[model samples]
Target: MTTHSLIVTGLAAGYGDSDILHDLDLTVPAGKITAIVGANACGKSTLLRAMSRLLKPRAGQVLLDGKSVHKTSPKELARTLGLLPQSPIAPEGITVADLVSRGRHPHQGLFGRWTREDDEAVRAALDVTKTGDIAERNVDELSGGQRQRVWIAMALAQETEVLLLDEPTTFLDINHQIEVLDLMTDLNQTRGTTIAMVLHDLNLAARYADYLIAMTAGRVHVSGSPETVLTEDNVRQVFGLESRVIADPTSGRPIMLPLGRHHVTQA
Candidate 1:
Protein backbone atom coordinates (compact mmCIF):
# COMPACT_ATOMS: atom_id res chain seq x y z
CA MET A 1 0.00 0.00 0.00
CA THR A 2 1.25 3.46 -0.88
CA THR A 3 0.72 6.50 1.32
CA HIS A 4 0.23 10.04 0.03
CA SER A 5 0.83 13.44 1.57
CA LEU A 6 -1.86 16.19 1.51
CA ILE A 7 -0.94 19.70 2.54
CA VAL A 8 -2.82 22.97 2.62
CA THR A 9 -1.19 26.37 2.75
CA GLY A 10 -2.70 29.81 3.23
CA LEU A 11 -6.06 28.55 1.99
CA ALA A 12 -8.82 31.13 1.74
CA ALA A 13 -12.08 29.97 0.19
CA GLY A 14 -15.80 30.65 0.30
CA TYR A 15 -18.96 31.03 -1.74
CA GLY A 16 -19.78 34.14 -3.74
CA ASP A 17 -18.01 37.01 -1.95
CA SER A 18 -17.78 35.62 1.58
CA ASP A 19 -14.77 33.66 2.81
CA ILE A 20 -15.58 30.74 5.04
CA LEU A 21 -11.97 29.58 5.45
CA HIS A 22 -9.31 32.18 6.00
CA ASP A 23 -5.58 31.75 5.51
CA LEU A 24 -5.82 28.16 6.70
CA ASP A 25 -2.90 25.81 6.74
CA LEU A 26 -2.84 22.08 7.46
CA THR A 27 -0.99 18.86 6.67
CA VAL A 28 -2.89 15.60 6.71
CA PRO A 29 -0.82 12.86 8.37
CA ALA A 30 -0.05 10.14 5.85
CA GLY A 31 -1.83 6.81 6.29
CA LYS A 32 -3.67 7.99 9.38
CA ILE A 33 -7.26 8.84 10.27
CA THR A 34 -7.78 12.57 10.83
CA ALA A 35 -10.99 14.10 12.12
CA ILE A 36 -11.79 17.81 11.70
CA VAL A 37 -14.20 19.03 14.40
CA GLY A 38 -15.77 22.34 15.32
CA ALA A 39 -19.01 23.99 16.25
CA ASN A 40 -21.70 24.84 13.71
CA ALA A 41 -20.75 27.35 10.98
CA CYS A 42 -17.08 26.98 11.91
CA GLY A 43 -15.93 26.27 8.33
CA LYS A 44 -15.36 22.54 8.78
CA SER A 45 -17.20 21.59 5.57
CA THR A 46 -15.77 24.54 3.70
CA LEU A 47 -12.25 23.47 4.57
CA LEU A 48 -12.94 19.98 3.31
CA ARG A 49 -14.42 21.27 0.06
CA ALA A 50 -11.31 23.31 -0.54
CA MET A 51 -9.04 20.36 0.17
CA SER A 52 -10.99 18.15 -2.23
CA ARG A 53 -11.06 20.83 -4.93
CA LEU A 54 -14.83 20.99 -4.86
CA LEU A 55 -14.57 24.65 -3.90
CA LYS A 56 -11.94 26.84 -5.47
CA PRO A 57 -9.53 28.61 -3.14
CA ARG A 58 -9.18 32.32 -3.51
CA ALA A 59 -5.68 32.22 -1.97
CA GLY A 60 -3.00 29.56 -1.39
CA GLN A 61 -3.38 26.02 -2.62
CA VAL A 62 -4.10 22.43 -1.68
CA LEU A 63 -1.11 20.25 -2.49
CA LEU A 64 -1.15 16.52 -3.00
CA ASP A 65 2.39 15.22 -2.81
CA GLY A 66 3.67 18.74 -3.42
CA LYS A 67 1.59 19.28 -6.57
CA SER A 68 -1.28 21.71 -6.66
CA VAL A 69 -4.63 19.93 -6.60
CA HIS A 70 -6.29 22.71 -8.52
CA LYS A 71 -3.77 22.21 -11.33
CA THR A 72 -4.18 18.48 -11.57
CA SER A 73 -6.35 17.07 -14.31
CA PRO A 74 -9.78 15.87 -13.23
CA LYS A 75 -9.25 12.24 -14.22
CA GLU A 76 -5.78 12.06 -12.69
CA LEU A 77 -6.83 13.72 -9.47
CA ALA A 78 -9.89 11.53 -9.09
CA ARG A 79 -7.70 8.49 -9.61
CA THR A 80 -5.46 9.49 -6.74
CA LEU A 81 -7.89 11.18 -4.35
CA GLY A 82 -11.49 10.15 -3.72
CA LEU A 83 -14.08 12.32 -2.00
CA LEU A 84 -17.50 11.43 -0.55
CA PRO A 85 -19.39 14.59 0.13
CA GLN A 86 -21.98 15.05 2.90
CA SER A 87 -24.98 14.33 0.75
CA PRO A 88 -24.24 12.38 -2.43
CA ILE A 89 -27.13 12.20 -4.83
CA ALA A 90 -27.50 9.22 -7.11
CA PRO A 91 -29.36 9.27 -10.41
CA GLU A 92 -32.96 8.34 -9.89
CA GLY A 93 -33.61 4.59 -10.39
CA ILE A 94 -29.93 3.70 -10.69
CA THR A 95 -29.08 0.26 -9.37
CA VAL A 96 -26.44 -0.25 -6.67
CA ALA A 97 -24.08 -2.04 -9.06
CA ASP A 98 -24.37 0.57 -11.76
CA LEU A 99 -23.72 3.48 -9.40
CA VAL A 100 -20.67 1.80 -7.91
CA SER A 101 -19.40 0.97 -11.38
CA ARG A 102 -19.11 4.70 -12.01
CA GLY A 103 -16.13 4.74 -9.71
CA ARG A 104 -14.09 3.07 -12.41
CA HIS A 105 -14.51 6.00 -14.77
CA PRO A 106 -11.25 7.63 -13.78
CA HIS A 107 -9.34 4.46 -14.38
CA GLN A 108 -10.84 3.93 -17.80
CA GLY A 109 -9.34 5.71 -20.75
CA LEU A 110 -11.54 7.77 -23.04
CA PHE A 111 -11.59 4.95 -25.57
CA GLY A 112 -10.99 2.15 -23.08
CA ARG A 113 -13.31 -0.71 -22.34
CA TRP A 114 -14.43 -2.13 -19.03
CA THR A 115 -12.28 -5.14 -18.25
CA ARG A 116 -12.31 -7.93 -15.71
CA GLU A 117 -10.20 -5.76 -13.43
CA ASP A 118 -13.09 -3.31 -13.17
CA ASP A 119 -15.46 -6.09 -12.26
CA GLU A 120 -13.14 -7.30 -9.54
CA ALA A 121 -12.76 -3.82 -8.12
CA VAL A 122 -16.51 -3.33 -7.90
CA ARG A 123 -16.99 -6.80 -6.43
CA ALA A 124 -14.34 -6.21 -3.77
CA ALA A 125 -15.86 -2.90 -2.82
CA LEU A 126 -19.33 -4.40 -2.50
CA ASP A 127 -18.00 -7.31 -0.48
CA VAL A 128 -16.06 -5.10 1.87
CA THR A 129 -19.07 -2.86 2.42
CA LYS A 130 -21.42 -5.86 2.67
CA THR A 131 -23.68 -4.42 -0.01
CA GLY A 132 -23.44 -7.28 -2.49
CA ASP A 133 -26.85 -8.68 -1.69
CA ILE A 134 -28.49 -5.42 -2.64
CA ALA A 135 -26.52 -4.91 -5.83
CA GLU A 136 -29.60 -5.29 -8.00
CA ARG A 137 -31.79 -2.97 -5.94
CA ASN A 138 -32.44 0.66 -6.78
CA VAL A 139 -30.27 3.10 -4.81
CA ASP A 140 -33.36 5.15 -3.92
CA GLU A 141 -34.99 2.13 -2.34
CA LEU A 142 -32.32 1.37 0.26
CA SER A 143 -32.44 2.72 3.79
CA GLY A 144 -30.22 5.62 4.78
CA GLY A 145 -27.51 3.42 6.32
CA GLN A 146 -27.46 1.10 3.33
CA ARG A 147 -27.36 4.02 0.93
CA GLN A 148 -24.39 5.53 2.74
CA ARG A 149 -22.54 2.22 2.54
CA VAL A 150 -23.17 2.06 -1.19
CA TRP A 151 -21.70 5.52 -1.62
CA ILE A 152 -18.66 4.45 0.37
CA ALA A 153 -18.39 1.37 -1.79
CA MET A 154 -18.25 3.61 -4.83
CA ALA A 155 -15.39 5.52 -3.30
CA LEU A 156 -13.59 2.30 -2.36
CA ALA A 157 -13.82 1.07 -5.92
CA GLN A 158 -12.00 4.16 -7.04
CA GLU A 159 -8.99 2.74 -5.18
CA THR A 160 -7.51 6.08 -4.27
CA GLU A 161 -4.68 6.37 -1.77
CA VAL A 162 -6.42 9.31 -0.11
CA LEU A 163 -10.09 9.52 0.88
CA LEU A 164 -11.84 12.65 2.17
CA LEU A 165 -15.29 12.61 3.72
CA ASP A 166 -17.59 15.42 4.83
CA GLU A 167 -19.64 14.54 7.89
CA PRO A 168 -19.99 10.91 6.87
CA THR A 169 -22.20 10.19 9.86
CA THR A 170 -24.77 12.89 9.37
CA PHE A 171 -28.37 11.63 9.72
CA LEU A 172 -27.18 8.25 10.97
CA ASP A 173 -28.36 6.77 14.25
CA ILE A 174 -25.83 5.78 16.90
CA ASN A 175 -25.58 2.20 15.71
CA HIS A 176 -25.24 3.24 12.06
CA GLN A 177 -22.79 5.94 12.95
CA ILE A 178 -20.52 3.42 14.61
CA GLU A 179 -21.00 1.08 11.71
CA VAL A 180 -19.94 3.70 9.14
CA LEU A 181 -16.95 4.80 11.23
CA ASP A 182 -15.87 1.21 11.78
CA LEU A 183 -16.03 0.67 8.04
CA MET A 184 -13.75 3.63 7.52
CA THR A 185 -11.36 2.25 10.14
CA ASP A 186 -11.30 -1.05 8.36
CA LEU A 187 -10.35 0.68 5.12
CA ASN A 188 -7.58 2.59 6.85
CA GLN A 189 -6.13 -0.44 8.62
CA THR A 190 -6.44 -2.93 5.81
CA ARG A 191 -5.54 -0.79 2.80
CA GLY A 192 -3.36 1.84 4.50
CA THR A 193 -5.50 4.53 2.90
CA THR A 194 -5.13 8.05 4.24
CA ILE A 195 -8.46 9.22 5.66
CA ALA A 196 -9.53 12.77 6.51
CA MET A 197 -13.08 13.49 7.62
CA VAL A 198 -15.20 16.23 9.14
CA LEU A 199 -17.06 15.01 12.20
CA HIS A 200 -19.52 16.86 14.45
CA ASP A 201 -19.46 14.47 17.37
CA LEU A 202 -16.47 15.31 19.55
CA ASN A 203 -16.51 12.05 21.47
CA LEU A 204 -16.77 9.96 18.33
CA ALA A 205 -13.99 11.97 16.72
CA ALA A 206 -11.71 11.43 19.72
CA ARG A 207 -12.57 7.77 19.87
CA TYR A 208 -11.83 7.02 16.22
CA ALA A 209 -9.37 9.60 14.91
CA ASP A 210 -5.60 9.26 15.16
CA TYR A 211 -5.35 13.02 14.82
CA LEU A 212 -7.81 15.77 15.75
CA ILE A 213 -8.13 19.21 14.21
CA ALA A 214 -10.34 21.72 15.95
CA MET A 215 -11.38 24.71 13.86
CA THR A 216 -12.93 28.01 14.85
CA ALA A 217 -14.09 30.96 12.78
CA GLY A 218 -12.48 29.63 9.60
CA ARG A 219 -9.12 28.84 11.19
CA VAL A 220 -7.57 25.86 12.88
CA HIS A 221 -7.52 26.42 16.64
CA VAL A 222 -5.28 23.41 17.40
CA SER A 223 -4.36 20.01 16.03
CA GLY A 224 -2.55 16.95 17.38
CA SER A 225 -3.17 13.51 18.79
CA PRO A 226 -6.54 12.90 20.38
CA GLU A 227 -4.96 12.88 23.81
CA THR A 228 -3.28 16.21 23.20
CA VAL A 229 -6.14 18.03 21.50
CA LEU A 230 -9.15 16.81 23.47
CA THR A 231 -8.43 18.63 26.69
CA GLU A 232 -10.82 20.54 28.93
CA ASP A 233 -9.15 23.80 28.04
CA ASN A 234 -9.13 23.01 24.34
CA VAL A 235 -12.80 22.05 24.36
CA ARG A 236 -13.66 25.21 26.24
CA GLN A 237 -11.68 27.25 23.76
CA VAL A 238 -12.84 25.49 20.61
CA PHE A 239 -16.46 24.66 21.44
CA GLY A 240 -17.03 27.35 24.08
CA LEU A 241 -18.55 24.76 26.36
CA GLU A 242 -17.66 23.65 29.85
CA SER A 243 -16.72 20.00 29.64
CA ARG A 244 -14.85 17.19 31.32
CA VAL A 245 -12.30 15.12 29.46
CA ILE A 246 -11.59 11.64 30.67
CA ALA A 247 -9.79 8.58 29.33
CA ASP A 248 -12.15 6.12 27.70
CA PRO A 249 -11.55 2.77 29.41
CA THR A 250 -12.25 0.72 26.32
CA SER A 251 -10.07 2.62 23.86
CA GLY A 252 -7.81 4.59 26.21
CA ARG A 253 -8.71 7.72 24.24
CA PRO A 254 -10.22 10.88 25.64
CA ILE A 255 -13.98 11.20 25.91
CA MET A 256 -15.58 14.59 26.42
CA LEU A 257 -18.52 15.02 28.79
CA PRO A 258 -20.25 18.34 28.25
CA LEU A 259 -21.39 20.26 31.33
CA GLY A 260 -24.66 22.12 30.99
CA ARG A 261 -26.40 24.71 33.18
CA HIS A 262 -28.93 22.26 34.57
CA HIS A 263 -26.22 19.96 35.92
CA VAL A 264 -25.79 21.66 39.29
CA THR A 265 -22.38 20.57 40.43
CA GLN A 266 -20.27 23.55 41.40
CA ALA A 267 -16.64 23.07 40.66
Candidate 2:
Protein backbone atom coordinates (compact mmCIF):
# COMPACT_ATOMS: atom_id res chain seq x y z
CA MET A 1 0.00 0.00 0.00
CA THR A 2 2.43 2.62 -1.14
CA THR A 3 1.08 6.14 -1.01
CA HIS A 4 1.32 8.26 -4.15
CA SER A 5 0.73 11.94 -4.70
CA LEU A 6 -1.04 13.37 -7.77
CA ILE A 7 -0.76 17.08 -8.32
CA VAL A 8 -2.00 19.37 -11.04
CA THR A 9 -0.30 22.72 -11.62
CA GLY A 10 -1.56 25.48 -13.82
CA LEU A 11 -3.34 22.95 -16.06
CA ALA A 12 -4.91 24.36 -19.21
CA ALA A 13 -6.48 21.82 -21.52
CA GLY A 14 -9.41 21.41 -23.87
CA TYR A 15 -10.57 20.21 -27.26
CA GLY A 16 -9.96 21.86 -30.63
CA ASP A 17 -9.63 25.58 -29.95
CA SER A 18 -11.56 25.79 -26.70
CA ASP A 19 -9.84 25.29 -23.36
CA ILE A 20 -12.07 23.54 -20.87
CA LEU A 21 -9.66 23.68 -17.92
CA HIS A 22 -8.14 27.06 -17.25
CA ASP A 23 -4.96 27.21 -15.19
CA LEU A 24 -6.40 24.72 -12.77
CA ASP A 25 -4.30 23.64 -9.80
CA LEU A 26 -5.16 20.77 -7.54
CA THR A 27 -3.52 18.24 -5.25
CA VAL A 28 -5.17 14.89 -4.75
CA PRO A 29 -4.71 13.92 -1.13
CA ALA A 30 -2.74 10.70 -0.91
CA GLY A 31 -4.74 7.58 -0.02
CA LYS A 32 -8.01 9.48 0.15
CA ILE A 33 -11.28 9.61 -1.77
CA THR A 34 -11.80 12.93 -3.55
CA ALA A 35 -14.96 13.77 -5.47
CA ILE A 36 -15.09 16.56 -8.03
CA VAL A 37 -18.61 17.98 -8.50
CA GLY A 38 -19.76 20.67 -10.84
CA ALA A 39 -22.43 21.68 -13.31
CA ASN A 40 -22.47 20.38 -16.88
CA ALA A 41 -19.37 21.07 -18.97
CA CYS A 42 -17.53 22.62 -16.05
CA GLY A 43 -14.21 20.88 -16.79
CA LYS A 44 -14.45 18.13 -14.23
CA SER A 45 -13.94 15.37 -16.77
CA THR A 46 -11.41 17.42 -18.69
CA LEU A 47 -9.34 17.86 -15.54
CA LEU A 48 -9.47 14.12 -14.99
CA ARG A 49 -8.42 13.42 -18.55
CA ALA A 50 -5.41 15.67 -18.15
CA MET A 51 -4.39 14.04 -14.89
CA SER A 52 -4.52 10.59 -16.45
CA ARG A 53 -2.63 11.77 -19.53
CA LEU A 54 -5.55 10.96 -21.83
CA LEU A 55 -5.65 14.58 -22.98
CA LYS A 56 -2.45 16.53 -23.31
CA PRO A 57 -2.31 19.72 -21.30
CA ARG A 58 -2.05 22.84 -23.39
CA ALA A 59 0.04 24.50 -20.69
CA GLY A 60 1.16 23.14 -17.32
CA GLN A 61 1.74 19.73 -15.83
CA VAL A 62 0.22 16.78 -14.06
CA LEU A 63 2.65 15.15 -11.72
CA LEU A 64 2.54 11.74 -10.07
CA ASP A 65 4.84 11.62 -7.06
CA GLY A 66 6.62 14.71 -8.42
CA LYS A 67 7.24 13.20 -11.85
CA SER A 68 5.61 14.60 -14.97
CA VAL A 69 2.87 12.32 -16.24
CA HIS A 70 3.19 13.52 -19.83
CA LYS A 71 6.82 12.47 -19.94
CA THR A 72 6.25 9.07 -18.37
CA SER A 73 6.07 6.04 -20.62
CA PRO A 74 2.59 4.76 -21.30
CA LYS A 75 3.18 1.36 -19.75
CA GLU A 76 4.91 2.87 -16.74
CA LEU A 77 2.21 5.41 -16.17
CA ALA A 78 -0.63 2.91 -16.64
CA ARG A 79 0.99 0.65 -14.10
CA THR A 80 0.76 3.39 -11.48
CA LEU A 81 -2.33 5.36 -12.55
CA GLY A 82 -5.53 3.65 -13.68
CA LEU A 83 -8.36 5.52 -15.34
CA LEU A 84 -12.00 4.49 -15.77
CA PRO A 85 -13.72 6.85 -18.15
CA GLN A 86 -17.47 7.46 -18.20
CA SER A 87 -18.06 5.28 -21.22
CA PRO A 88 -15.59 2.44 -21.59
CA ILE A 89 -15.97 0.42 -24.76
CA ALA A 90 -15.09 -3.23 -24.77
CA PRO A 91 -14.09 -5.19 -27.82
CA GLU A 92 -17.12 -6.79 -29.43
CA GLY A 93 -17.81 -10.27 -28.06
CA ILE A 94 -15.11 -10.15 -25.38
CA THR A 95 -15.83 -12.29 -22.36
CA VAL A 96 -15.81 -10.87 -18.85
CA ALA A 97 -12.67 -12.79 -17.89
CA ASP A 98 -10.85 -11.62 -21.00
CA LEU A 99 -11.84 -8.02 -20.46
CA VAL A 100 -10.62 -8.02 -16.89
CA SER A 101 -7.37 -9.58 -17.99
CA ARG A 102 -6.67 -6.51 -20.13
CA GLY A 103 -5.79 -4.65 -16.95
CA ARG A 104 -2.63 -6.69 -16.75
CA HIS A 105 -1.38 -5.29 -20.04
CA PRO A 106 0.80 -2.66 -18.41
CA HIS A 107 2.63 -5.27 -16.39
CA GLN A 108 3.22 -7.54 -19.33
CA GLY A 109 6.06 -7.13 -21.79
CA LEU A 110 5.75 -7.31 -25.54
CA PHE A 111 6.47 -11.02 -25.46
CA GLY A 112 5.48 -11.65 -21.89
CA ARG A 113 3.41 -14.66 -21.04
CA TRP A 114 0.55 -14.71 -18.54
CA THR A 115 1.82 -15.79 -15.16
CA ARG A 116 0.25 -17.01 -11.96
CA GLU A 117 0.36 -13.48 -10.56
CA ASP A 118 -1.78 -12.21 -13.41
CA ASP A 119 -4.35 -14.93 -12.78
CA GLU A 120 -4.41 -14.12 -9.06
CA ALA A 121 -4.80 -10.41 -9.70
CA VAL A 122 -7.68 -10.95 -12.09
CA ARG A 123 -9.30 -13.42 -9.70
CA ALA A 124 -9.01 -11.04 -6.78
CA ALA A 125 -10.49 -8.17 -8.78
CA LEU A 126 -13.43 -10.24 -9.96
CA ASP A 127 -14.09 -11.52 -6.46
CA VAL A 128 -14.00 -8.06 -4.92
CA THR A 129 -16.32 -6.66 -7.58
CA LYS A 130 -18.62 -9.74 -7.34
CA THR A 131 -18.16 -10.28 -11.06
CA GLY A 132 -16.55 -13.69 -10.77
CA ASP A 133 -19.90 -15.39 -11.21
CA ILE A 134 -20.15 -13.89 -14.66
CA ALA A 135 -16.48 -14.29 -15.54
CA GLU A 136 -17.17 -16.38 -18.59
CA ARG A 137 -20.19 -14.40 -19.78
CA ASN A 138 -20.00 -11.99 -22.69
CA VAL A 139 -19.50 -8.41 -21.56
CA ASP A 140 -22.13 -7.00 -23.92
CA GLU A 141 -24.75 -9.41 -22.64
CA LEU A 142 -24.61 -8.21 -19.03
CA SER A 143 -26.96 -5.56 -17.65
CA GLY A 144 -25.78 -1.98 -17.26
CA GLY A 145 -25.05 -2.36 -13.56
CA GLN A 146 -23.21 -5.61 -14.14
CA ARG A 147 -21.25 -4.04 -16.99
CA GLN A 148 -20.20 -1.13 -14.82
CA ARG A 149 -19.00 -3.53 -12.16
CA VAL A 150 -16.97 -5.40 -14.73
CA TRP A 151 -15.35 -2.18 -15.83
CA ILE A 152 -14.48 -1.41 -12.23
CA ALA A 153 -13.11 -4.92 -11.90
CA MET A 154 -10.79 -4.20 -14.78
CA ALA A 155 -9.57 -1.08 -13.02
CA LEU A 156 -9.10 -2.99 -9.79
CA ALA A 157 -7.13 -5.64 -11.59
CA GLN A 158 -4.78 -2.97 -12.83
CA GLU A 159 -3.77 -2.45 -9.19
CA THR A 160 -2.74 1.15 -9.65
CA GLU A 161 -1.87 3.29 -6.66
CA VAL A 162 -3.70 6.30 -8.11
CA LEU A 163 -7.06 5.94 -9.88
CA LEU A 164 -9.06 8.55 -11.77
CA LEU A 165 -12.71 7.85 -12.48
CA ASP A 166 -14.87 10.01 -14.73
CA GLU A 167 -18.52 9.70 -13.76
CA PRO A 168 -18.19 6.14 -12.53
CA THR A 169 -21.76 6.14 -11.33
CA THR A 170 -23.29 7.21 -14.61
CA PHE A 171 -26.38 5.22 -15.62
CA LEU A 172 -26.49 3.34 -12.32
CA ASP A 173 -29.64 3.05 -10.24
CA ILE A 174 -29.67 4.33 -6.67
CA ASN A 175 -28.82 0.98 -5.14
CA HIS A 176 -26.07 0.33 -7.65
CA GLN A 177 -24.70 3.80 -7.12
CA ILE A 178 -24.40 3.22 -3.39
CA GLU A 179 -22.87 -0.15 -4.01
CA VAL A 180 -20.20 1.28 -6.30
CA LEU A 181 -19.32 4.15 -4.01
CA ASP A 182 -19.14 1.83 -1.04
CA LEU A 183 -16.87 -0.45 -2.98
CA MET A 184 -14.54 2.43 -3.73
CA THR A 185 -14.45 3.35 -0.05
CA ASP A 186 -13.62 -0.22 0.78
CA LEU A 187 -10.70 -0.11 -1.61
CA ASN A 188 -9.39 3.06 -0.06
CA GLN A 189 -9.72 1.65 3.41
CA THR A 190 -8.17 -1.71 2.63
CA ARG A 191 -5.55 -0.91 0.02
CA GLY A 192 -4.88 2.77 0.69
CA THR A 193 -5.42 3.58 -2.97
CA THR A 194 -5.68 7.23 -3.93
CA ILE A 195 -8.92 7.89 -5.82
CA ALA A 196 -10.15 11.04 -7.55
CA MET A 197 -13.52 10.95 -9.29
CA VAL A 198 -16.06 13.24 -10.94
CA LEU A 199 -19.55 12.90 -9.56
CA HIS A 200 -22.84 14.66 -10.38
CA ASP A 201 -24.69 13.78 -7.20
CA LEU A 202 -23.66 16.38 -4.66
CA ASN A 203 -25.11 14.61 -1.64
CA LEU A 204 -23.56 11.31 -2.55
CA ALA A 205 -20.24 13.01 -3.10
CA ALA A 206 -20.46 14.67 0.28
CA ARG A 207 -21.29 11.39 1.95
CA TYR A 208 -18.60 9.25 0.32
CA ALA A 209 -15.77 11.63 -0.36
CA ASP A 210 -13.24 12.65 2.25
CA TYR A 211 -12.72 15.82 0.22
CA LEU A 212 -15.07 17.70 -2.12
CA ILE A 213 -14.21 19.98 -5.04
CA ALA A 214 -16.79 22.22 -6.66
CA MET A 215 -15.95 23.61 -10.08
CA THR A 216 -17.46 26.42 -12.10
CA ALA A 217 -16.55 27.66 -15.56
CA GLY A 218 -13.35 25.61 -15.85
CA ARG A 219 -11.96 26.51 -12.45
CA VAL A 220 -12.29 25.18 -8.95
CA HIS A 221 -14.70 27.48 -7.16
CA VAL A 222 -14.34 25.87 -3.76
CA SER A 223 -12.91 22.73 -2.18
CA GLY A 224 -12.48 21.23 1.28
CA SER A 225 -14.25 18.85 3.61
CA PRO A 226 -17.95 18.41 2.92
CA GLU A 227 -18.95 20.83 5.65
CA THR A 228 -16.67 23.49 4.29
CA VAL A 229 -17.43 23.08 0.61
CA LEU A 230 -21.19 22.32 0.58
CA THR A 231 -22.45 25.50 2.18
CA GLU A 232 -25.50 27.44 0.95
CA ASP A 233 -23.44 30.28 -0.48
CA ASN A 234 -21.07 27.96 -2.36
CA VAL A 235 -23.99 25.93 -3.75
CA ARG A 236 -25.78 29.09 -4.90
CA GLN A 237 -22.68 30.40 -6.62
CA VAL A 238 -21.62 27.11 -8.18
CA PHE A 239 -24.96 25.68 -9.28
CA GLY A 240 -26.86 28.95 -9.76
CA LEU A 241 -29.67 27.55 -7.63
CA GLU A 242 -30.99 28.33 -4.22
CA SER A 243 -30.47 25.46 -1.82
CA ARG A 244 -30.41 24.62 1.85
CA VAL A 245 -27.54 22.55 3.25
CA ILE A 246 -28.35 20.26 6.12
CA ALA A 247 -26.50 17.56 8.00
CA ASP A 248 -27.35 14.11 6.73
CA PRO A 249 -28.55 12.14 9.75
CA THR A 250 -27.02 8.93 8.48
CA SER A 251 -23.54 10.18 7.53
CA GLY A 252 -23.41 13.51 9.31
CA ARG A 253 -22.23 15.06 6.07
CA PRO A 254 -23.92 18.02 4.47
CA ILE A 255 -26.75 17.24 2.07
CA MET A 256 -28.24 19.89 -0.20
CA LEU A 257 -31.95 20.43 -0.72
CA PRO A 258 -32.64 22.51 -3.75
CA LEU A 259 -35.18 25.33 -3.40
CA GLY A 260 -37.01 25.83 -6.64
CA ARG A 261 -39.52 28.51 -7.54
CA HIS A 262 -42.48 26.42 -6.43
CA HIS A 263 -41.11 25.49 -3.01
CA VAL A 264 -41.38 28.69 -1.05
CA THR A 265 -41.93 29.51 2.59
CA GLN A 266 -43.02 33.00 3.52
CA ALA A 267 -40.61 34.83 5.80
Q: Output the number of the TM-score-best candidate.
A: 2
Give each model's whole-structure lDDT: 0.94, 0.93
lDDT tens readout by residue for model 1, 160-221: 99999999999988999999999999999999999999999999999999999999999999
Which residue pairs of candidate 2 clash?
A: none
TM-score of candidate 2 on Cα atoms, chains taken together = 0.98
Residue-by-residue lDDT tens digits, candidate 2, 1-267: 689988889999999999999999888899999999999999998999899989999999999999999999989999999999989899999999999999999999898699999999999999989999999999989988899999999999999988889999999999999999999999899889999999999999999999999999999898899999999999989999889889999979999998888856841
lDDT of 1: 0.94
TM-score of each: 0.97, 0.98
Q: Candidate 1: deviation at residue 213, Å?
A: 0.6
What TM-score does structure 1 among the candidates reach? 0.97
* Model 1 lDDT-worst window of ten: 258-267
